[model samples]
Target: MTNTALTGVIPPVCTPLTPSYEVDTGSLTRLVDHLVAGGVDALFLLGSTSEVAFLPDRHRKVVLDTVVGHVAGQVPVLAGVIDMTTPRVLDHVDTAVAAGVDAIVATAPFYARTHPAEIRAHFRAIAARAGRPLYAYDLPVSVHTKLGTDLVLDLAAEGVLAGVKDSSGDDGGLRAVILGRRERADIADFSVLTGSELTVDSALWMGASGVVPGLGNVDPHGYVRLVRAARAGDWAAARAEQERLFHLFELVTVGGTRMGGSSSALGAFKAALHLRGVIDHPTTAPPQIPLDEDETARVGKYLAAGGLI
Candidate 1:
């Protein structure tokens, strides 16, 4: 495959499982097709949205292969290769590359508190073997290790690092990444993506390339429109659209749902997708609890009110 830098809206796609807990490849394909039809730039299959850690190795490969086959080279596919160890991450990168992925989206090791040198080593090792571009997924909130702007810019300077998925939710870090490019005209094309739905519009306005929002699982069109409009400099339209999705973002993020718990934002996102008929089922992998009836109902009300369902 040719080397392609990941840019624009990349949906960290939610895994669509059957009620019986089997991988629903059909539903997964349909969701990818829907996103592509709606104009998403890439599909981040098997990432946080797909519960990468919870999935068995076999299941992970199956999901990646399925998405690659479905996409059939119409657009780029960034396989998420997040793991605690460098060797394992490199192996996953090889697997994804073997499966015909265009790029890899990797996060810093979780619970390990790795230093910048280790993080840089991990990414550099993977990029060397994969022969593809890499999107640094700097999600300090999800994974404990933080890939600060200085290290991120350094990696990008080395030329293998394509860009960063700046989910740090730190406006300060986001601003630093944006301004780094402005100050250095040579690397301005390097992307800084927003991981939070709330900051999608602002991130774009501040020179971010795109977003990797979870709520895009329910309303891919709206998220896509927000990014496109922001890129087009239509601030009024972008803000209005962002406001429309803000409630749903809040509802899903309530109770610190992104972290491990019974009330998972991941589960909520899959449930919302299932309700919208974009996917067949909404079951999360083990250890991630499903939304109970009351919770699902509350979310459904918000989605319905938002015309998401």
Candidate 2:
């Protein structure tokens, strides 16, 4: 892969599942078409929004092959090599690469406590083996270790990383990475993408290259509009659209009281997709509770208000 940094709206594509909790390839194709039609620049598969951790290895492979074949180079596809440690993640990297992904996003080693040095080594090892451009996924919420700005910038300087996805929810920390990248001339192409969906305008203002919004699955055009408005320097329009999406994002909380955060958010996203006729059903992975009728109806209202349904 070229050192060119990935930019623009790259949505974390959702996986469409059948009632039996299997990959609904037909619905998955429709969902991909929905996103491409809405003007996304790239597609991120097997990320958190895709319920990657819950999926079996074969299912993950199915998703990669399906999307890569369906896309046919229309947009670059980025796959997540998310796992507990370097070795396991390398297996995923090999799979993603063989399946023809353009880039691979990985999180720091998790499930066991690791020092900063160990984390750095983990990434260095992956970069040495991945054979594709590697982007660090800084999701402290799951990884349990905040990837500090210095660590990220240092790795970028060493060419061990191509970019970073700042989903840590610390805008202050994220701003530091953006500013740090700007200060360095050698790694100028180091892409600083924000996973903080609601604050994309602010992230862009801080010099972020793009976004990896999960909400982009439900409303890809809205995020594309947000990015366009920001690029055009229409801050007011960007702010207005962001606020509207913020309201639409309320759908994620409908089932919050009954299930975990991940379950609720993923369910709401799938429910909205099903209501919009993009997917076949709203069945989340096993152990993750599915939304009942009332909860799904709340998702419908949000989509309707957002003019999606």
Question: Where does candidate 2 stray beyond 4 Å?
Answer: 1-5
Per-residue lDDT of model 1, residues 1-309, tens digit only: 332345578888888888877789999998888888888887887777777877878888889899998899988888999887888888898889899988888887766767788888888987798888888888776788778887888888887688888777788889898899678755645777788888788888777778887778778889988878887889999999999999777557532543454346877787777777888777887766677777777778888878876
Residue pairs with colliding backbones in model 2 are none
Evaluate residue 286 in candidate 1 and report its C-alpha lDDT on the 0 to 100 scale. 72
Deviation (Å) of 208 in candidate 2 = 0.7
Q: Which ten residues in a row have the lowest lDDT in candidate 1?
A: 254-263
Write one digit per residue (lDDT tens) for candidate 2, span 151-228.
999999999999999899999999999889888886668989999778998899888999999999999999999999
Task: Give the Cα lDDT of each candidate.
Answer: 0.80, 0.92
Task: State, as a TM-score between 0 and 1, how close model 2 is to the true structure.
Answer: 0.98
